[model samples]
Target chain A: MKKIAKMVCILVVSLVPTLGHGAFQAIGIIKSVEGEVYLISSSTEIQAVSNMKLISGDNIITGNDGSVGLIFKDDTVVSLGPNSQIEVQDFVFNPAEEKLSFAARLVRGTFSFITGQIAKLAPKKVKLTTPDATLGVRGTKFVVEVK
Target chain B: MNRSLRVLSFLILSSIVTVLTYSGCSKTTVVLLKDPEGKVGHLVVENEAGSVDITKENEATTIAGATSKPAAPKRYSEDKISSQFGEALNMLPTQPKHFILYFKSGSTELTDSSKAQIPDILKTIELRSSEDISVVGHTDTAGNSAYNMRLSQRRASVVRKLLIGEGVRADHIQSTSHGEANPLVKTADNVNEPKNRRVEVVVR
Candidate 1:
């Protein structure tokens, strides 16, 4: 039993250093996944589970019955409805240094967003871009379905 | 303040005149939000329809006809449009914000690479409105439990000092040490794992 735990810990350690080496950090974790949710990073797709760390450049997709919720470092909450696709373009939350930003591209489907500390502190820095238009936040919450 | 009120009343009076004169077509819908303290945000309506500006909180204007100007601003309530904004949280990623500063064997000082990650951690603190922080220190299993506990406490203290020096409110931070009890790498007793001897800082 001890050997198994040790090996598992070793494997996890070896796998972490190879991920997300740039300034793009893991901005949030998967709080819950209802149905089919996949995280596509680089070129490989991995099944997403609760507590899975997500980073920039990762594309999140949900199946017809799928939905995902995430609680970000800035205490911002996000829920992606089914049949949705989203790409995290960039995310930066450095409260001590006062550098906070959030930008994402929602290709299609439905999503509900609650503005985070970044938006509360600096509303102009947050942008949500879709194919037809770009959405900015003045209010704290918005839900949109892109046709 | 009086001048602004006068301008607003004048605009309302003129809009009333325009609506009465041009009340020949579609009905005008005025969506008003109730914010006596006026703490709402502005919304710029620029879809396929003509552009309209809702500058003040909880107020909106809709013209009666296609080419007519918008009617006077009206107040809207929070419950009226609550459903319009979905409740699904759209959160940014949070994983990268968690930072771990590794230590050399038998030393509480940060390793070279860990030293480099400090600036980013400080920057993270600067971005938040308030600090909600946790610092947990650990040591490799190379030493006895008692000694490791003290060592880990020292390490946590070092980080706490740095954070306080860099502007993190001292009271907002909680620090603890788990010497050789929990290991990131799960090394055997008397083994030295750089990853195991570390301090983890979580900021929420």
Candidate 2:
């Protein structure tokens, strides 16, 4: 019986990460889209639509007339302008465990960002990287353009 | 004659500075703006060369390259900014909304006044196409910590069921419990606080 109980404990511990939270959960949602926006994940590209859940590691690409808006679980808002590409590199918002992080990369084009709970709770953990420089956000609204 | 020369030189220098600031825009540029609440936060633009801090609204910095430092922040006109980033700025998502519902002590039942808010809550969830809702439960310090945790979980589930019955998708709702760890009103162990026994629903 003791051996069986130990095995059960190990199974539960291993399953914790894959539960309906953490890395398996949706990090944000596409709130608005215009023109020709596409979401690329796992080498698959799909036309972007409002209310679509987005996970980390997903790439958002826009055409010449495309624009998109997204809202993360922690209320962070990100918008991309025409002819833009951005990657959601990392995002973790687990307030209960005090594990908070937000990171993204803008390869080109224009971006608008508004800080959320993650930045307010742990400002240093938030980062927005561009080709030339990286922005360390401190709970603010900002815009970036990369030529 | 010297005074006039100084004024003329100042004008020339100012114009030159303006030209440099605006002309070097081929690289990455970051501009700080105020939030919807009219609050401006600071940002740090850093690279291998150095870092530039932006504090004021409409302040901007340009980074020429990875090896070069960020430029000193300069105030940009509203017209210039709108012309560059108007599309992105206009696409910002609406802010999330939060609602709190009080619960009866030691049970999954909601208070009378809180029950009356169900209609409004349902309306909020209905308005958003792919709305995501989080129902977090909390309890006052009126019981054992272990028991309180279980109680809060039940409370959260209760709210979750109510939303689902009202047409909210079960997959869109995430239910969790914080027990008495996060109390609206702090108190000693085993103290009963009505405000602390509540569930918070965030609609995004």
Candidate 3:
């Protein structure tokens, strides 16, 4: 029994550090909510995760059943409709110090996005990929729908 | 002398009459060809104010006062996907995988090391652009359920914000706060297990 307890303690101790390693910061907001869908992020760092601080490199997404919203650190707003999926592929800020590479994938459904400062500085740094095509934005308001 | 003078005058008169008749006949033929339907074609003249109409007969239609021809209709090209990328993307997981993003106790801030992992997540989504994504937020059993729910939402929102900033459309994400309802490690109340305090990302 003593040996079993000691082994169990060792296993728990080994796992603790790995568990605390990764977390996300909140950098945006949820602007509106519909029946089962929500429109989030209008501009800047209006929203962040409840317990986490949203930093420059975090990724935000919707929940199952197609619902949620996000506002980024740079007053950029994004709204997701039903049955949609997107990912934040990359991001970098501080143009004078470092450049950002922003990329996303639209798996399915519709999404509306507003441009931000980072997008304006280096438009080629940002890319939105769909199953059919990849959208290279140079500072513009656009809607992407993927089926 | 009188006969010679009369002959010369007659030749001159005939030659002049012949030339006049030939010129008149050529003019009529030219005019016939110019008037295809016997009604002049309407000339469309565009200016800054608007379009003006002028009727005239001509061999070719023309837009008067316009410097250039009308533009052709625009055509869109199809998306080109390489076969290799398509095959590789097909082998990826279809259902959303659960990834735990652990946070410090009582703090929602993501550390520098934690931020590094975001690129991998983004790359996975980019590689599998055909799949939908779902991110669920959860917390340890230390806090109140209501508070935890709100906290989980905050965590989800953080991910949502980061993804959008990275160019993900706002509509592609849905955030829900499980509020410690689904614990990964499942310890007693206020145990402070790092695994339980996390946000799970599942790509569908």
**Residue-level lDDT tens digits of model 2 in B54-131:** 999999999986667899999999998999999999998777777889998788999999999989888887786646
- Model 1 chain A: worst 10 consecutive residues (lDDT sum): A11-20
Highest lDDT against the true fold, candidate = 2
Runs of candidate 1 with Cα error greater than 4 angstroms are A1-24, A95-98, B1-204
Local accuracy of candidate 3 as per-residue lDDT tens digits, A43-124? 3433323222334343344344444444443434455555555666554443323345667766555565555544655566
Stretches > 4 Å off in candidate 3 = A1-147, B1-95
Q: Name the lDDT of candidate 2.
A: 0.84
Instruction: Using DockQ, give the best candidate's number.
Output: 2
Which candidate order results from sorting by lDDT in descending order? Answer: 2, 1, 3
**What's the DockQ for every one of the candidates?**
0.07, 0.32, 0.02
lDDT of 1 by residue, B1-204 (tens): 699999999999998887565444333332323222335555443323345656564565544443455555665566654543233332322322468899989998899999898788888766643345667788989979999999989998999999898888997676877787767776679998888888887665
Better of 1 and 2 by DockQ: 2
TM-score of 2: 0.82
State each model's TM-score restricted to chain B.
Answer: 0.55, 0.78, 0.52
Error of 1 at B65 (Å): 21
